[model samples]
Target: MRLLDNIYAGERVSAADAVRLFELNLTELGAVADFRRRQAVPDERVGYIVDRIVNYSNRCVACCEFCAFHADAGMIAPYDLSFEEIIEKIGELVVGGGTQVMLQGGLHPDHPLDWYLDLLRCVKTSFPHIWLHSFSPAEIVHIAILEGMSHGEVIGRMKTAGLDSVPGASDLLVDSVRRRVSPRKCTRGQWREVMLALRDADMVSSATMTYGLDETLEERVEHLCFVRTVQDETGILQAFIPWSFSPANTRMCEVAPAGGVDYLKTVAVARIVLDNVDHIQAGWLTEGPELAQLALCMGANDMGGVLTEELVVQAAGIHTRLTAADMEDLIQNAGKIPMRRDSRYQELGHEG
Candidate 1:
């Protein structure tokens, strides 16, 4: 109760307090988290975005143990979307009234930094109105390492080329978990450095966490603290998104996946812990719409995006899709106003 009292008194919860909050029953945790959510949001409105995630290439050298989306060179024939193909995808998004495009891809071994810059320029030239919220810190780090450039230089160039914002795809922010799951990908320190670079460039981005990868709850709390610390320093993180890891069809297929209760608890705890971040996103792509709908009451204020197409989680054998209309209806049915938002959490319109 004291923890809840402190949280309600506008005091920042410590890491130990976050871990203890996870020990509370679901109802108690959700109630406190919902209280924090109302204090932060102060509105009965839930926001969703009409966006698309374009995986330009599946070929990845990271070989993360939890990933089912990446293809090794010889395991499967890799394909990179031709510039024309990517344009076609964005065109389809535009036709669906999409305002944002997230160009996510694996760490391809051969692509040069110029290749990404050119793609960003090409997308901007083709659809200047579409918000290009693309790429993760891992991809930026890969580019920087490939080109012998600093992370700041890579982000600066991408910003100039019309990259509106970056996604916080630094899957698990704990170094221990990163070593166990994604050894070849950027380390926790590198991820922080790239985020600092984004802040330096005055570019806003989101923070994400993928739990249930055999990580301890304390490690999960550590991840939240890391995000909060970065937000305290940079103030560039606009949202915090926490999703359960899907292990099917991947190397870690033997691992039992997290269930809906864990997912909801994570969402509620994230909302309570990430007090500095403005928005907390509910991930329907992995958890399905029903649980995501329940997440609205458990502290999440954003339903993420109506992903026109999502392959990463689908590759793990979880296929959940929603259209803009479905999003509006879902939010309204949840007893909240359905507001459409862009990449920066700016309300575009609403359907009450």
Candidate 2:
């Protein structure tokens, strides 16, 4: 009750106290988080996006142990999608009534900066109205590595080339946990730097947590605190998405995956802790729509995108294909009005 009272009174909980939240009942956590969600976002409408995730290349240089999506360099048939091929994907998205496309890919070590810029140009040139919510902080850093430029410089150039926003991918934020899982990916400093740069460029992005990768409970709370700090400073993060780690077919496949209880607890804690971040999205792709529906009352305000198509998580053995209608039904079933939104969190329309 004190936790709920404190949260409702708008006080920040310490990291140690946050870790103790795990000891409480799952439904209690969800109830407090739902209370906070109502306090911040009183709307009974939950937002969903009609978007597709496009993987431009499976080629990767980062030796992330958790990823089964990447094709290691010089091993097997790793290839980048030709610009024309990418355009075709965009065409499908346009035809499918998709308002956004998440252009995700491995850190293609061979591609130059111009190659990415050209792709952005091509997308904007071909589809002017589609929100180009592409690339992760990791990808930006990779481009910087290839181009011998700063992360800020790469982000600025991408913005110039019509990149509307960035995704908070590869963000297991705690450096110790990150070193264990993705030592070759961007560091916490680099991730924070890129996010701040996006804020400076007026490009809002999401904050994410990919937990269950052998991280401590305190570390999880640390991640929430870190994102909240950034939000307090910039107030530009549009949402926070917490997803459980899927170990299927990965190098770390021997480990057991995070369960539904952990997923709900993380989502609820995120909603309660990330007081400055307006939105919290549950990953239906990884957690399934059933639990994702339960996550609505557990302090999630967004159902995320329908994801007409996806690949990375699919490679990790997660493939939940939900259309716009499926997403609307799921949200409605959760007792929330289903509202469609763009990548920028702009309300497009209501389903009912």
Best by lDDT: 1
State candidate 1's TM-score.
Answer: 0.97
- In candidate 1, residue 121 scores what lDDT? 97
Clashes of each: 0, 0
Candidate 2 lDDT over residue span 1-352, tens digit each: 7876787787888888789888889878888899889988899889998888888888888868888888852222576888898889889989988888889887887789888889999999999998988889888888888889988899899889989998777467889988888988999888888888888888888888999988889999999999888788778789999998888878888878999999999999898888898899978889999999999989998988877668778878776888788889998989999989878777899665
How does each model score on lDDT? Answer: 0.89, 0.86
Residue-wise C-alpha lDDT for candidate 1, range 1-352, written one tens digit per residue: 7888898787888899898987888999898899999998999989898899998889899989998888852333577889999999999999878999999999988999999999999999999999999999999999999999999999999999999899988688898888899999999888889889998999988899999999999999999999999999889998988998887777887889898988999999999889898799888788888888899999999998887778888788777778888899988888889989988788999754
Q: Local error of candidate 1 at 262, Å?
A: 1.2
Give the winner by TM-score.
1
Q: Looking at candidate 1, what is the lDDT of residue 344?
A: 76
